[model samples]
Target: MSAPDTNTETQHPAHKTPLAGIAIGVGVAVALLIALMVWLAYNGNEPRDASDGAAAVQIETPTGGSLTITGTASD
Candidate 1:
């Protein structure tokens, strides 16, 4: 009695893991968050709705002879 030969050229599907997909998703989310923070920080430095102003005041000193002081005693 003769036995039939089995085929040895059949291909099997490659195995895949879920860790790679999860890592890529997390990386994208982190990159977007960092970009948003940088944009907000740059735009937050602009000045708005305010104006600059200044003011001045006058000063004076006494000029009377009776108000003057001397180091010598007066007789």
Candidate 2:
């Protein structure tokens, strides 16, 4: 005659996920980046250099003349 089987040691513990914390961290980082970008965009519209002092030159030969423009360098 066999005795009845009993298992008393099996156990599974509850786990806490770190995904919530990670999600919040990432969200805060994205928000800060967006804020920085917005600030830069808002303040970046001011012209750094003054164009009021720009000058053009003109040259003349015996039969022809030429004009040289100063501030029109194209990349």
> Which 10-residue window of candidate 1 scores lowest in summed lDDT?
66-75
For candidate 1, the per-residue lDDT at 42 reads 83
Off by over 4 Å in 2: 1-17, 48-75
Q: Per-residue error at 33 for model 2, in Å? A: 0.8
Tell me model 1's lDDT, rounded to 2 decimals: 0.55
lDDT of 1 at 47: 40
- Give the whole-model CA lDDT for all candidates, comma-separated: 0.55, 0.64
Query: What TM-score do all the candidates reach, one by one?
Result: 0.40, 0.41
Clashes of each: 0, 0
Using lDDT as the measure, the top candidate is 2
**lDDT score, residue 33, model 1?**
100
